[model samples]
Every structure is written in structure tokens, then in C-alpha cells.
Target: MGGSGFLGGELVRRSVMDGRVVAATYLSRPGAAAGADWLPLDVRDRTAVAALIGEFGPDIVVNAAFRQSDWVTTAMGAAHVAVATSENGGRLVHVSSDAVFSGKAVTYTENCVPDPITPYGAAKAAAETAVQAIDPTAVIARTSLIVGDGGSPHEDLVRSLATGGRNGVLFTDDVRCPVHVRDLSAALLELANSDRAGIHHVAGADAVSRYELGCLIARRDGFDPARLPFGRRADTDLPGPVDVRLDCGLTQRHLRTRLRGAREFVK
Candidate 1:
């Protein structure tokens, strides 16, 4: 539903490139989605969600709208979208995050139970539970750090760290399987068109530490990787490194689409 955001924007662009009739939804920004039919939607408002869904009567709905600061928009709003999509008999592909899992596990399968350690993780877990309860046929695609050609928030943050725009150390111990934006968007579109229901891990093919990812980006983008210092979770009082390495073998086998790793896209 968030056509303005990174992954959402890519979906819109790719849909248009594929010659699909697209109606994108935005929360506060209108011009964020350049092409396609733009619709102002506040998912937190249940009535607004229903009205939009009824009028549009979309065949497939992808819930990409999320906010970390606002629980109402992130969790409850997802629930609203799921319920509305279910009521309309529309196929739903909800975007979830790897944050739903605790870092205790080295690798997480699709069947891994969610045990979030952070508030954002907890909210995402709640959203997944709510979506499944409301619509059993909904596809919950849990992804890791999203990176691509166009600037994403995660990529921007890494750039800031490399350029000294942001004063934060990258974690060397933290591990994640970052999926390219195009690959992820394509996978979501495929799942949206299919009848596949239940949780699925749609992430990168390779796992790497956050420090390695940041350094890769810095070197590729002509920034000094040495400017970015590394932070060890074991040495600090802060919450330790989280290893959200998802096993995307099921996704690789299910769909013909190939999920490229961060190494391929960093450059």
C-alpha cells in the first residue's frame, strides 16, 4: 500500500514497466509515486481502507505500508488491510520483516516461531499473527535488509556512516541476508498473482555481516570504508548483534525468480 517507499516505489515502477494497470497508495506524500494512478490512503483508518479497497476492487493487494514509530500504522494498519483484502476476496501479499525473529537462531526457516527482541520486531510479529488470523490465504513474505539501485533508507544510512553524515558505528557481528529491491519486488508480484498462502522467507541468497555490507557499499560508491568504524556487540552495553539470516531455499525452489545476494548488487 506504500507506493512511495523504497520497495513500494520499485513495485510501482516495475508494474508500469510490465504494462500493468497500477493504482498506488500513499500515506502523506502524493508525488512520491510518479507515474500510475495515485490514491491517498491512511491505512490506520479502517473505513478509509475499506472504501479504497471497495472502490478500487483490486485483484491483488500488497501491503507494503509500514512505520516503525507508529504502532497504529505499522501493526493495526496491516491488520486492516488484511481484513479488507480478505473481505473483498482479493489475493493478499503482505510484506513482513526478519525482525520478527530473535537472533538466537543461526538460520531461520519459514516455520520458525517468532520471538522478537525489539519493539519493532514485536510489532511485526503481531502484524503477522493478525494477518494470518484474519486471512488464512494471505501470503506473508518476510524479508531482510532491502538494497538496490535507487536510494533506500538502509542504503542511505550506510552512506551516511561512510561519509560522516551520520555518527554511528556499523556492527560487525550483526548478520543479515539483504535482498535486492528489484528481486524482492518481482518475487512479491509473483506471490501476489499466486494462491500461495502462509509464511515464506524471500531474502538474499547469501548471508553477510553488517560491517561487511557497509564496507562493500562504501568501496563500491567511492567512499573510504576505513572511515566507518566497527562496533562489537559483545563489548558494548547496547543490545547485542542480531543474526537474522533467513533460509530462502523454499522461495528459490517455489518461484522461478532468482533472489540475488548483496554482493551482486552492492556495486
Candidate 2:
């Protein structure tokens, strides 16, 4: 529903390219993505969500709307969308995050119980629980850090750190499986058109440390890698790093699409 966001924009572009009629929702930032009808939506409002779904009557409702700083919008909003979509008899493909797990395990499968350590992760985990309870058939695709040709939040943070615009230390211990925006978007659309339901791990094939990711991004973007300082979560006196590595084998087996690694697309 977040047509202006990176992933949402990519999905809209791909949907239009495939000649599908697309209607997207935006909040504060108006979406400039072409070939899609845009509408203002406050997903936090249950009545508004139901009304919007009734107006659109979309065969598949994709809830890509999220705000990191706003839990009401990110967590409860997902529940509202799920319940509304379920009542309307529409398939729901809710985009989720890998942060839903604690970094305790080496790798996570779709069946892994959520044990979030961060506030954002907790919110995501709660959203997943609510969605499943309200709509058991909805496809909850939990993905990791998203990157691609078009700049994303992850790339923006890396660029800021690499160029010394933002003074922050990259954690060598924190690891994540980052997926390309286009690849994930295409896979979401495929799932939207299919009957697959339940949780799916849609992420990159490789997992890399945040420190390594910053260095690779710096080298690829013509920035000084030396400017990015590497630090450990333990040394920083912060909570332990949320090192999540998703097992996307099930996703790969279920879909024909191949999600590539960060190293393959950074250049």
C-alpha cells in the first residue's frame, strides 16, 4: 500500500510493465510512480481500511505500508489490513521483516518462533501474530534488508556513514541477508497471483556482516571505505547485535524466481 516507498515503487513499476491495472495507497508523501492510480490511506484506521478495500475490490491486497518510527502504523495497521482483506475475501500478501527473530539462532526457517529483541522487531512479530490469527491464509513474506539499483534506506545509511555525513559505527558482528528490491518485488507479485499461503522467507542467498556490507557498498559507490569505522555491539555497550540469517531454501523451492545476493548486484 506504500506506493512511494522503495519496494512499493518497484512493485508498482513491475505491475504496470506487466499490463496489470494497479491502484496504490500513499500517506504523507505522494507517490510519483507511473501507471498506477494513487489514493491517500491511513491504514491505522480500521474503517478507512475497510472502505478503501471495498472501493478497490482488489483480487490481491499487498500491505507494503510501514513506518519504522510509528508502531501504530507499522504493527496495528497490518492487523487492520489483514482483517479487512479477509472479510472482503481478497488474498493478502503482507510484507514482513527478518527482525522478527532474536539473533540467537544461526539460521531461521518459516516455522521458527519469533523472539524479537528490538522494538521494531517486536512490533513486526506482533503484526505477524495478529495477521495469522485474523487471516490464516494470508502470505506473510518476511524479508531482510532491501537494496538495489534505485537507492534504499540501507544504501542511504551506508552512504551517509561512508561519506561521514552521519557519524555511526558499522557493526562487524551484526549480520543480515539483504535482498534486491526488484527480485523481492517480482517474487511478491508472483505470490500475490498464486495460492501460496503462510509465512515465507524471501531474502538474499548470502548473509554478510553489516561492516562488510558498508565496505562493499563504499567500494561500489566510489566512496572511501576507510571513513566507515567498524565496531562490535559488545564494545559499544549496546544490546547484542540482531544477527539474523534466513533460510530461503523453502522459498527457492516454491518459486521459480531466483533471488540474488548483495555481492552480485552492488556493482
lDDT of 2 at 180: 93
110-167 per-residue lDDT for model 2 (tens digits): 9999988778788888899999999989999999989886488778888888777888
Q: Candidate 1: which stretches are off by over 4 Å?
A: 239-241
Candidate 2: RMSD over Cα atoms? 1.4
Candidate 1: count the clashes: 0
Worst-scoring 10-residue span by lDDT in model 1: 232-241
Which ten contiguous residues of candidate 2 have the minimum total lDDT? 233-242
Model 1 scores a TM of 0.95
